[model samples]
Target: MAASEKQVVVVGVDESDYGVHALEWTIDHLFAPSMPDYPFKLIVVHARPSAASTAGLVGPGAAEVFPIVDADLKRSAARLVQKAKDLCASKSVHDVTIEVVEGDARNVLCDAVQKHNASILVVGSHGYGAIKRAVLGSVSDYCAHHAHCTVMIVKKPKAKH
Candidate 1:
């Protein structure tokens, strides 16, 4: 594929409302335009769980949480991507390419951008402070600075008072 015409989009997914917002942005701004005309390829990614999580599930009702019995992070990631695709398809946005990539959100996204020759990278911002985010550099911040293509960070809506 020529570097000139190469185009693709990557989204970071998690349980956060921010991720959902990013999904919506991708649908409306990117995917919606190509729907039913020619299928657009979208890469939906989810961060993997930490190694310590394997020690055992946390909180009450852990066993019944996922409720799938053998549900794993990889499986959950795949499911979330499919769920996004299904959402788009229901609205006639068919032919989305889904993949569940594991690892750090920023790295995974950057890697995907390079791998698929993506022209844009989208992520959701938690709107945390520098000190707070310093301990955890925001994925949006990271991709915006490092990605090969344009980066769009979806800011989470303020909560209702």
Candidate 2:
């Protein structure tokens, strides 16, 4: 890999424990000391529900119902991004970028993969049960099938009793 061919890995992130676990796993498994050097860069992507979705949730006139909720959402997204950056920094992974966009999570992640020309798209599993998955769907599941690049779904390590 040359200067123009930096290796980029895009990972979906959120405030969830699984999200943090995915980021940590990527650093440990992909960028560990034993890996070959290629100017690796990690891109953290988070997707917030669209403003329309928020508006709908608040009610018909909710678009103007509460500006505070919109503001709060933005702040929350920023905080999550910052936390992810800090985690990367602590792990000695400095070449990191944060992307917080409002849209469907699956689309946001897929778009990031194409925009970054990422060779791998990493996401964490929430381990939703059959009922929940049928109702709410899974981000990792969508990404695995739709991402332009290779997809890695990181699962939380199970604890031993």
Candidate 3:
């Protein structure tokens, strides 16, 4: 691809409502009527957490159980990416590409941006408390600063009290 031929808009997705919101926001705001002038590919990315995390949680004898857990995780990730693809198709955004990668969410997403030659990366914020965010490290926060492309962090709607 040429230096001026940047294509593909990469969106980080998952099974959460926040992920859905990010996809919807992309369709509603960026690709709604479709821009012929700025035609681009839509690459929906979902980062599956490493199986080691679960293996560690299940204790020492986890080797026997890790395969089952890993399989389930793969199935769940496939379902999530498929749902995101279907949602985009329903919004008239067909020809979407789905990528299910494994690793830390931040690294996976940033890597996707570079791999896809995307100019923009969209992700949703989970709105965790400050302490939780500090401890866990927000994916959106990491992507905003680390991604090679421009980043859009969508916020999920607040529930009515």
List clashing residue pairs in candidate 2. none
Per-residue CA lDDT of model 2 for 11-97, tens digit only, reads 898879999899999998887866646366788999987655766664476757557678878888888988898888787777788
Ranking by TM-score: 3, 2, 1
For every candidate, C-alpha RMSD to the true structure in Å: 5.0, 2.2, 2.3
Question: Which residue pairs in candidate 3 collide?
Answer: none
Quantify all predictions' global Cα lDDT against the true fold: 0.73, 0.86, 0.86
Winner of 1 and 3 under lDDT:
3
Q: 1-161 in candidate 1: lDDT tens per residue?
A: 54444367777777677887887878887666545454346777776664334435677777665444335665766677777777677666665666665567788888888998887778898999989899967888888888899898888778899
Write model 3 residue lDDT over 77-158, tens digit each, in one string.
9789778878887878776888898888889999998898789999999999999999989999999999998999999989
**Alpha-carbon runs more than 4 Å astray in model 2:** 1-4, 33-39, 58-61
Q: Give the TM-score of candidate 2.
A: 0.88
Tell how far residue 94 is off in model 1, in angstroms. 1.3
Candidate 1, lDDT over the whole model: 0.73
Sort all candidates by lDDT, best to worst.
3, 2, 1
Model 1 residue runs over 4 Å out of place are: 1-6, 33-40, 50-71
Which 10 successive residues of model 3 have the least lDDT summed?
A: 32-41
